[model samples]
Target: MRRQTARLYLAALSKYCGSRLGKLLGVGCGNGEFLAEASLKGFDVSGLDVSADAVQTTNTLLGREVARCSTIERAGLPDHHFDVCVCGYVIEHTREPLEFLSEVHHVLKPDGVLLLVTAASGSRPVTLENALLRTGFRSVEMMTSASRVLVLARARVRRPRPLVSVIVPVHNEHRTVARLLETLTAKELTGADKEIIVVESNSNDGSRVDVLRFAGTPGVQIVLQDRPLGKGSAVRQGLRHARGDIILIQDADLEYEIDDYDSVIEPVRTFQCAVVLGSRHSGNGKIRVFADQWLLGLVFNSGHVILTGLFNLLYRQALKDPWTMYKVFRSDCLHNLKFECNRFNFDVELLAKLIRKGHTPLEVPVNYRSRSFKEGKKIRVISDPWTWVWACLKYRVVSPYGGDCTRRTENEMGDVPDTP
Candidate 1:
């Protein structure tokens, strides 16, 4: 199982590395744990550790030209020195990580790969390298999880873009579920592995009758909530069973356009980010015009903007629309995330929680359409928004990751990455 996961991690890395056997540089590579593993796989490898003792250990273990070095460039390596340079866990331990990364970029060939992995130091979005985007590169790809960091970048210059996901949260949205399914089925599903998961919560609504409707589809699945959970619970519930390479939360209602899917999935697909938010209103004059439930939709979206913006300001991270139903994420990166809300504000709470958990949401635009309260719309003018706001503020104001992971993982069966 451990070997299987390492292969998956390697296969995933090759999507960026583009080579199997090539010159490898392990920088600040103490004791050469990660590097030794790679060298054992039969690649020509070398190590440069900041600690003299660690460098001696690497030479003893791998019998490579391990050297005592403080910087990547002075490691006595040749120009365009390596095919891939891997600097794991040591980036965060440095005062000038970019200087380290710059040394890395200088040593790699034009087609060379740099796999730099770091753990999030604090529960905040921006980190060491993000503070120095212009040191030597124009575009890059970064993949992050609750505790891991992975980045892909170029040394010279080019255009940069972000990958996106379409998130749709559903509770008992069975009535119009087929509209969403058929619309996605009719799109250009051939180019990418697009997916839709219908979150069927503990619905007393006749919608569950409609949920069992799509049991035969190949890509789409209906995930039922455990216990009597809420809309957020259903969304959280479905995520456990979601198999999308990238997760897009799709509502059963077909009010949104099927054509808008491509622009949304690109950034994350290209390794730009982990979460991509689909915005209903963005980049003016480019508007989505709709008629039914016009006034209520307007009020709902207006309230949504105010709520999300307030959330961004409060959380200390730049997240847009904390309450939007359509949010997307990379499937593997979301592992081990704990959500609090059993209802709607779960989006708001999750956003703020991610901010504290050292992640951020990249907002992208999408079309918006809403139905009347009589037409199956669920947002009510009661204390619901207040409940969401309180949860958002409370979680944002506190530290959430200090909890015990073993206790948390005990109840979540598939939440942890299984090596096999």
Candidate 2:
């Protein structure tokens, strides 16, 4: 009865926090009962108990000496070492519960979750919530059962969060290049490490100078091309230098808003998706185009719909706008495939390659502001459409260099690799 109750509560608590698998520190580990159950559930379990006998017994039973004879506040564990900190029926007995929580918070990595279980009296949920928030927790919630109160709180910032590489491909975007850098560098990205890699192609408008201004800035890499090689080539170069868990593509132009960055990176961060593409056609059914006042607008919209329809039919996937500049994907998806084109066909190639690898991108509605041709809009109606169509057909039928012609089912297409 005792082990069952502890296992049930711990399982529920772990699920409520995030997952059952991580480096877990169980405060007040008594006889290794709960930690044993947690270890079976895939947690890298360790323990702290004030009783030396209890700690020794736990270490003996678990077959390894993971349990230490120490209290929560003075356990002397390494900082930011654990993905989760669990205190079951220990906080209530601590001389200083606030200090205990602070210690636990210190040991947890940024974005790590802390689970607390205690008798459902004395320290009410309201008090516990305030205490946790005051000690650097971003959010806190409590669940009540017949005899226990379970609290879950996530650390405000992890010390070493996964880096997100932002690849900006630019050509003659001198006007907006500075603003783009400022926005990318100055934004407060919670629970994320950031790297900015800017690939600037040949531009006579002093765009190189604009990019050079951030030359020595931390976490920023600048690549200047002597001659214009097209956006695809610049992006491919940027991807080569990228060192991040998540790769995000941004345009040098200001048409796509930077404020949608959170939404763009969320799906990949939460592991809910392997690829997310921002759709210019997603929200309100209203769109902007360089020639909205002319027939070009109608032509562009029709082309988008027809091409997108064909893409869906061929790949058997639903993608709203595959041409959008705001595409975020896991770094692994780029593996085992080679990019041939260095032009705008890059977009079609990217989508086709990902689909062939069984990665279907989810579309998130993003805000878009169109620029007129006089306002520096690129891409002509006649030539680019043919290039896009050819890319779609070529990749759809022919095998990419060093790629498989046999398509795998969705299950075979693995998701993001697990992070311990």
Error of 2 at 186 (Å): 0.9
Worst 10 residues of 2 by lDDT: 411-420
- lDDT string for model 1 (55-81, tens) is 887677667665465666566567676
Estimate the lDDT of model 1: 0.60
* TM-score of every candidate: 0.59, 0.59
| Candidate RMSDs in order | 10.9, 11.7
**Cα error of candidate 1 at position 293, Å:** 6.6
> Candidate 1 has what TM-score?
0.59
